[model samples]
Target: MKRIVIALALVLCAAQPTLADKVAAPIPIGIAVAQTSNVALFGQEQVNGAKLAEERLNAAGGVNGTKIALVFQDTAGDEAGAVNAFQNLLNRDKVVAIIGPTLSQQAFAANPIADRAKTPVVGPSNTAKGIPEIGEFVGRISAPMTQVAPNSLKQAMKIKPDLKRVAVLYAQNDAFSSSETTTFQDAIKELGLETVTVQKFQTTDTDFTTQVTAVLGANADLVVISGLAADSGNLVKQLRQLGYKGLIVGGNGLNSPNMFPVCGALCNDVLVAQAYSPGAVDKNPVNKDFAAAFEAAYKKGPAQFSAQAYAAVQVVVEALAKIEKETGKKIADFELADLRAALNKSLRTGTYLTPMGEISMAPSGEVQQKDFYVSKIVMNPDGKTGSFVLVSE
Candidate 1:
């Protein structure tokens, strides 16, 4: 009888799930970004930023003792590619939540999948207006173009108050570019400035001579460019090479330091509206630490997208931690509905300290903070190009 009782006890012990086993199953977080195409330069930076966040979270023992495993999918910077990447992450990888689809166009195409799956998605860089209109599942850390565009306009006016004629150049194929162009046009109209010419180009276009000729022929006082970094940088270089010496204003697409390489000396005097700046003198602790750590890791300054991506991941990790504290259960077994509620509640009320200063989300998934700055590229006396001055509203 004693032997039989001991045998039954052993069987029961083997059937029980151990805490170590539970914690061993890491929670999968999806990273969907444009890793391959025209926007790859910016997307690569966003990927690095997300990876940095993942590394930090995992090193701190992860959320609720469960490790975080990042699964990356390349969207290739197109609508179809975004759909495929999102579906693969959702259906094949079974990620609890997805982090990006960097471009606003990709987000518009891919966010609906997460919505239908009831999986939460936080955009790292989708700044186009009406992103929140996608669904309740959609959220973004980046400020909308409605806010970013006016900063460039304000800076342009400061440089040339009598800038009446503005020429707009944009990539018609990109939703983000189109949306930004609309914002620029609207802001110019409000300022009583006439749009002398609106030129369109493809993302794949290598030469902008024809477009530059058209813009210059219009005799505009300012030229505003709305496109991805690669195309926008080339456009700026081509405009200068074509002898169009007017003031240049770049939209969110030209906010990266990589633009300097494309335009070289021509990048001087160009002004851009930025959502994040390591050079910003904000006294927030979060921004200070993030700026330091980012420079240490990447050996370069962080951009608005990088800062926002870091913040988005931070908020998600916080939500996971909160869920664990409340339920005392692993995040993997947590229901999507419960997780979504926790995330929404946490994101809305909680203050996040990112490299862009303090940011919070509203119930409608809109970012509560409207912090933006205008920075001009100046070639210092030493011949090094940098954002010399930042003008803030």
Candidate 2:
């Protein structure tokens, strides 16, 4: 009888759940970005940066002892694709938050879905004007067109104080390009410069002979380009081929190193305002470590999009950890309403040490930082491409 009772007690005790078994599953984060398309170069860099953040967060035991799993969905740089991607992430994957849609146009479409679903989204590089106006759910780390375009204009004026009669070329169909063009136009007017000619093209259009000819005929002293890498590169090449060799200023879209392959020798002497410079003399350990890791993984330096994506993920993860610490509940347990409120409050007050530099978010979801530099594309003696001489603002 005693043996029988002991055996029954042992079986009952074994059937009871252990503390480890009660632990929650890992949190799921959705990464909606343009993995393939004209923006793939920038998108790939953003993914690499986000992955680095994931690795670091996991290595540190993740947020509140729960691992974070990044689920990726390609937006394909289109509105329909972005809507579908966001739907899949929210309905099927059931992610806690989303982190992309690189282009501002895609964000304009996809972010509404997230807002309606009450899911938070942090943009890695959506710099179009009026992005945050989508809703309270959308936030971005990249500087707006209003900020970046003026910086480029200021750099152009510095290079040629007498710069006047500016020629502007942009993709009229692209939201980012349109927004940037407006800023460039306003900046030129503010600087007391004349707008000689304005040329427009669609992103799908390849040949820019007519626009280049118009710009050349306008006899402009400066040419400003507002388009993506692929379009911007072609425009630069065509502009140079047309023999208009005054000063060239590129908007944020032309800041990528990929422009080298697009414009080749034509890329030389083109000035771009940069948001991130790995070689910057700033004494931040986070920047140094991120730059090294990025170079090792990507075989090249990280761009502004990469830095912004990394920073966005870091901020989200930090907010999740803070919520868990305060409430003692997993991220999955928090209601979407409460979570969004907490996220906004936390992001505004929290300081993030990103690859770009330390960043703080304002109440309006605008990133606040004092770091913008100008870099010129110059070919090395070996014919390899690189940026030289960081100019202070």
C-alpha lDDT (0 to 100) for residue 366 of candidate 1: 80
Model 2 residue pairs with clashes: none
Error of 1 at 160 (Å): 3.3
Q: What is the alpha-carbon lDDT of model 1 when measured against the actual structure?
A: 0.79
Worst 10 residues of 1 by lDDT: 15-24
User: What is the Å distance of residue 214 in model 1 from its true position?
Assistant: 4.5
**Cα miss at 339, model 2 (Å)?**
3.5
Which 10 successive residues of model 2 have the least lDDT summed? 15-24
Top candidate by TM-score: 2
Please provide the root mean square deviation of candidate 2 (C-alpha atoms, Å). 10.2
Q: In candidate 1, residue 347 scores what lDDT?
A: 58
